[model samples]
Target: MSHAPDLGSSAAPGAGAGQREGLGELFSSVTEDLSTLVRQEIALAKAEATQSGKRAGKGAGLLAGAGVSGHFVLLFLSVAAWWGLGEVIGRGWSALVVAAVWAVVAAVLAVRGRSELRAVRGLPDTTSTLQKVPSALKGHEEENHR
Candidate 1:
């Protein structure tokens, strides 16, 4: 009579070798899954960064266009004012008056801009949160192990 190896029985030497092979397959599967997850996360981060950069670039371009348009408007208005003043006073005095008005406006803007820049501080809260990241990760790892 021939005997068949019982599937559930591990008493046979061949069964032990088969179990080791199964463990090796499980380990390889886990490694592959982990590698795939890391690659997907990196791709997501890169896509997000690229999208943000594009948005920032578009906004900057729009801002530059607005600034140029505003400059042209200001230039036309200044010339019109100078010509209108020239019709009443002499051309030389009208030019001097326009120059003085622009200088005063420039001074006021510079002062305001300086004060506003001084008010802006560094990102204290974000810096504090980033400093705690390592400890937070370590605690999370401990919780997961438990």
Candidate 2:
């Protein structure tokens, strides 16, 4: 019994060693490669974004816990200061002093927070790269025409 040649082999039937691939075949191969590359790139980006999102979520949760712990520390310190002063200057005046101190702290925090918010610049690099995309595409098209 004789076996037939494999259809999946690189050598096509009736093609000689000197033969080159047709334009249609070359174009088809390039298109397929480009499509696969785009799909792989998208998958990579999605995986990266998912990993970043999980990290951000975990960081936010830890920060919230830190905030609560900090608040309790401040509360206990404030109470201790008030009680210590009350023994010296009396209860009413010590309470007033604590309230005034907190008011000043609040004012300072509000001013600093506002200034920090004003300094925020959002997504500058992403915006710049996105703006360049159209020009890049135009350049590619011009090259193809040439």
Candidate 3:
């Protein structure tokens, strides 16, 4: 299943020091290139993971902002109601009563926001899955060789 080019047809060498080019030197150069490539790929992977984390963080922050804004809206509405309904309910007690109701509303919204945060935890797990794929493939290679 390897996609590597076959070395058989090429002018690539075997174990002869002066034979066109040393296989060890060729292998060393190839390994050096591979190492550089792997390092670059790792950097790219890290950047991708960091981006995903930022996106998830932004999403969670947005949800929290929504919950907070909802709470503020309800609280402000209750405050507005208190101003209007002060005559019907007792003047001093209406503000306290309205605030109590709005507090309950805020609590409910907070609970909902907490439930929504669970999905953000999956983001890092997604990146970890990607990181493990190479190791998993290497394990398969070992099994095949056995």
Candidate 4:
């Protein structure tokens, strides 16, 4: 009877070692990729924050300019109206009438401002998401137990 070669003994000596080395290289590559991803995400966040801040600054500057120009316009218009009315009525009566008109406007503005302030719902989405965190954690705990 012919004897067959032992299959187990025919295997290469370095095969297991080569496989272990490949695994180590794969793990290192994965770690490096994850680290790079985190760095990229942080860079993106910083860039977005910088862009938002620049936009907010520009908007504030424009609003300030508009406010100053609007104040000047109102001042000139009020003076013109007072002079025109003074020709029909006396200067004192015309001034009093303008003062009363401004008073009514101030009252209306105050009431509207109060209503708008009351309508403000601060960070509703953030509040709702925060409330879900505990339930989410509980679900994870149940999964782990199973």
- The TM-scores, one per candidate, come to 0.44, 0.43, 0.42, 0.43
lDDT values, one for every candidate: 0.58, 0.56, 0.61, 0.57
Q: Write the per-residue lDDT of candidate 4 for residues 1-146, one digit (tens) a residue.
A: 76997667656546777888999998898678667755765665566666655655555554555455455556655875767666775664566566566555555544554554454444444444445545544554233222
Q: Candidate 3 — number of clashing residue pairs?
A: 0
For candidate 3, lDDT tens digit of each residue in 26-110?
A: 7787678667756766776676678667656765765676677567667666676767576765654666666666667666656
Per-residue lDDT tens digits of candidate 1, residues 1-146?
A: 65976767656677788899999998898678667755765665566666655655555554555455456556756775767676765664555565666555655554554554454443443444445545544555333222
lDDT of 2 at 75: 68
Best by TM-score: 1
Q: Which ranges in model 2 have alpha carbons more than 4 Å from their true place?
A: 1-21, 86-146
Q: Which candidate achieves the best lDDT against the true structure?
A: 3
Model 2 per-residue lDDT tens digits across residues 49-97 = 6665665555555455545545655765577576767677566456556
Lowest summed lDDT across 10 adjacent residues in model 2 is found at: 137-146
Off by over 4 Å in 4: 1-14, 87-146
**Model 3 TM-score?**
0.42
Which window of ten consecutive residues has the lowest lDDT sum in model 3? 137-146
